[model samples]
Target chain A: MDAIDCDVHCAPDSYEALFPHLSEYWRQYITEAGIRVNGLAHAYPRGVGATAPSTYEALADRVLDRRGVRFVILNCLTGFETHRNAYFGAAVASAINDWVREEFLARDEGLRASLVVSTISPEDAVAEIERVGEDRRFVQVLLPVRSDLPWGHKNNHAVFAAARERGLQVALHAWGRAGKAPTPSGFTTTYLEDYVGNQSIAQGQVLSFVSEGVFERFPDLRVVLIECGFAWLPPLLWRFDKDWKGVWREVPWLGRRPSEYVREHFRATTAPAHLPRDPVLLDQLLEMLDGPGMLTYASDYPHEHGDGLAGLLDRLGEEQRRSVMWSTAAELYGLAGNPAASSRA
Target chain B: MSHVEVRSGGAPVTKRGVELVDCDVHAQATEPMLAQYLSAPARRLLERYGRRTPRVTEWYPRARNAGMRVDAWPGKPGHIWGSDPELMRAQLLDEFGIDYAVLEVLSGQDCYDHPDFAAEWNHAINQWQLEEWLSFDPRLRGTIAVPHEYPALAVAEIERRAGDERFVAVLLPASAAEQLGSPKYWPIYEAAAAYGRPVAFHTGGYVDHRGPGYPSYYLEYHVGNGIVMQSQLASMVAGGMFEAVPGLRVVLTECGVAWAAALQWSLDAAWELMRDDHPRLERRPSEYIREHVWFTTQPIEEPDDPKQLVWAIEQAGIGERLLFATDYPHWDFDSPKQALPRVMDASLRRAILCENALELYGLPRERAVP
Candidate 1:
């Protein structure tokens, strides 16, 4: 079976690595500002500990070749989402996309990319998508999960429309630059609170998409929640379904239960996949989610977790494993006919 | 073809008969009536500036129900459902056969910018509960609402009310200016612990105090409540609130228990990575959660299959930690009998519906005279 790593991350080796990707204007500005580096530190405090020895080349060698991965979608978190200046946000996102292309995708045909965009200006974001949409190597349009408005709000529809036009899935990764506070309550004091709170932001955005009828508006548009824990998905959908039954009149366009929209239009990555205290319960949680069909594999590289796919794969049945490992992502990025769908089996 | 069960008022009873103790039952004060209980200065502040809580944007305008169940509004022209204790009794306590229901008023006391005024306003609301709601029915109990900004006064209120068995716990807004974990809030936790009362977090406060920022819509606001609780849980544990107040217990109301399982995992991992930061923590953070934390089940999360509720309960190890609540007069009230999964185990159902809440509130086990 061909496995797909939907959320493998790589950071710029240095800020200067993006110098070539930036315009002369941004280059001069960044140089003058001495904005020396890009890492998770810009989003939150840095401490992923245990950096994996494997870079993209080694991932191609070890995971793609050895672990039977046909495709690896590279996600770069850095400061792309956190940059406050709209133009700088666009520049940083563009630079990261370009850096990922030259550093990872150019070397490995199996690798794919996300056109990271700044949502500070939807027009700029749409323009960024248009610039990068033609590159078949880029499988999705990426934005930070936290934004000024919920993902379903009309403010974000322009981004979705642009992504839909290109046949690109929209990926909302957890660490976006903070729009206000990381949560509705206010800013968190600790990184631990911030990290755990990211899942809550993801849940709100998912609710927005379902309640606002974003999927109904853009039927072909798909959303993949990256690094947001999937355990919340089953319960969240269930809660939304019940709430919608009582409040559907508020949003008449919603044709069915919130979970129905979720099952069809949305997909999630299993990076920091929670292992319920009862391992059997984890299997059952997936069952409530209609099995692993809605889930795609993600290794969330450089983040420390003892078990990734091995932990989940051991509990899942064969069909569920096949779906989670490759086929689901294969269809998601429209990679079915491409070499990304090739199999060892 | 389709098999589903629907009941008008609530669910039909099953054989393992045990009455429930609802941990979260809201009672709103009728406007001018609560003003009567307030001190003169606080009353003037209320009349002049209204609530001074920071306002953030909320995009989804509340439905005509005002984000409440349509049927919840009291039939009378001016009054809302939660405003009248007699109506609340007929609808919630009597309908569900709840033996004991904790009365937490949505006073908007936490919204006040001035600590003294907030303290007085919350005190008046608590007094209004005793005079208005709790006096109406013995089955109804009250929680001392304290202005979190004024810790000494908050503790004094807890100490003042601790004498009355009718007041079983102290209520604080989940999203506060400072996390409930901070040293500033510890005095309040200390008082609750001293009184052998749990500090309960009922959702909703100043829109600005809510973490992240204002949610664009009410639906986003609703879902985001769980996020606020998760942050508080993490902050309280990692920031060493439990370690500081050894006897304190925390009840997370409205925030569903199912989310706790995922949170427990995150907490455990973070503690392992940053154990040194919390030198006082004796065991893993999840252990503190299971031991000290209790979750009320309203807006109770329902998976597609009935068994997933049991799975979530099992995952959180909160069969005993879960307390049943209706969140009376609110939009998403869970009918005690019908709300839980149909296939739930008799023992587990009994535990969630009654025994757990009794143990948490230090209430007696005897059934109410029906």
Candidate 2:
């Protein structure tokens, strides 16, 4: 069985190219300052083996033509990530969504995209979803994980409503913002820390959404936390239920178990699976996590080393392996057209 | 049909063929038991500041459901610290198949009666942690809790307790009266370092003491996990706790994982800007976190994506630093099996369930059953 690295990510074209198609209002904000997550200082430098920022023709050529792979699900850098100026954050989010619809998805049938949105201003994010969600090609809604608060705050329901209206999954990515920054005793940080930080962000985001009854409101609104990893899954589900029982009076609507909601609505991707190659450890993780379907494989292409190789897909049972590769994501993003199996089987 | 049978061996056996090491199991302290080990001065402080005795009980009535009358919440049975030890043992170690349980006690009420009698009060708490908590059960492991006001005394307390085999680590409120893990609190870490014990920075009470800027409510405190998350994690990283004590290891307990990715990235950015400040450090702030820090995830209520958990580990590159913690007896305790999607594969479970924890705490997997 060949490995199908379904979560492989590649950026397409530069911001300048994507900017032209955005609305005049968005174009103004995007032009004034580059994209940036609110508090995160890191920048999305370039895609792996990138030439010309990231181009669709180049991305498709690399992804579809790979000698030994099933597909690469490209996670586009949120258009709003490059610009730190919060004033234009909303406009840039709209423009990024517009670029995906007009250029990448409109021109090619072989591509999938995570539509970027403005996390600061949920209204603009909702507007962006309304504008781009109509396209069948737009499979996911990508929002920066880097914000003063996790994206699940009740105030952000407008964005959730928009995505739910279009049957689109919310793609949570690692990005940072200002105000209420974690730890004021600023110090030098490292890449490894950034990786773990992403997971922490996802944990907070998932908790906020569940505690706020986000799933209860939009049962169909699946929140796929791509690139955050799966190590925390076991403890998170445990802690939420444990804490919820003690504080259930605070959140009246959390009737069902938190995991039940997660099983129904969330999907996570495994790129650069961090643990060492120990069969025993991996086995226990699967048992603890309960299954591989929730742990999809992503190449995170444009980086020096992609997610995994053909050897990995061959390691699991046929059914389990297929779900991680394509079926799970296909169902998640409501991609009725993709060539994935229909049934959970 | 297959039944899990331990065939006369000393290795853990399970249905999925996996063992677990819970890094953050908690223990409850009884006033009498903890008071026994306290000195005259410490004992008085506990009776005074810890309990704030001669007190009036105020009730904020709440309804369990709609149309119900509001009443003071006594909380669930065994809600704070279940009276039974065997029950805790089975739930934390046996049920989850965990081998080690890093026990953090239920911290007493705070902000009032602090600063003046601080060390004495903390000594009382630490005495209970070591005396009553250490022997709660075979699975229970304990840490020394200290009063943050007296950093030097807190350090001294840690040094005294570090030699005990039962004492696994030291606990500090990431937010007491002041932001924790800051340079101001380096003495606490220094004491931890002297004993080769790790610092378990647990989150609580920051909402009451600090300005979280959120409306008062249970959800606000619980949901705004970042109130402590921001100050503690950020303070540790930015304050160069890692730099101050290169050999020191920091632990984050019951704090959610959502802010970690951004916080770490922001720190790395800050690391560049504040190069002159932390001139003694060899690497970036995130580097110390990757190497020396560990976090516990329980009641993982947020984020539906199981892979994002892995992504987070990868992002932090602290897989070794991650420990599967169940804040048992408290609100967010989790069953190992119930924590993750039942479909997760075996290899991933092994790392999250046991190996990672064993490596993190440097513990031997007891040959209880195979």
Q: Which one is best on DockQ? A: 1
Where is the poorest 10-residue window by lDDT in model 2 chain A?
A179-188
C-alpha lDDT (0 to 100) for residue B21 of candidate 1:
84
Instruction: Give the per-residue lDDT digits (tens) of candidate 2, residues B85-169.
Output: 5666655567656656777764542433444455655666666665555665555677786665667766776777777767777
Q: In angstroms, how far off is B313's CA in candidate 2?
A: 18
Q: List the DockQ of the predictions in order.
A: 0.33, 0.06
Best by lDDT: 1
**Model 2: CA > 4 A from native:** A1-15, A22-52, A68-73, A80-87, A178-188, A243-250, A304-312, A334-345, B1-170, B174-185, B195-200, B203-370
Candidate 1: list runs displaced more than 4 Å: A42-46, A50-66, A79-82, A178-180, A336-345, B1-18, B54-60, B69-79, B209-214, B273-280, B367-370
lDDT of 1 by residue, B176-251 (tens): 7766677888999999999999998888765452322334556656666776677778778877788888899989
Per candidate, the number of residue pairs that clash is: 13, 109
lDDT of 2 by residue, A1-345 (tens): 233344445443445665565567665654575643321224333322333225567666666666545434556564534445555666656656666556555655555667777666777778778887776666667876655555666778888888877767787765444333322212214333333455555666677677778899987787877666555565567546655666677778877977777767777776545432445445545655667767665666654323232434545788988677666765665444333532111
> Local error of candidate 1 at A238, Å?
1.1
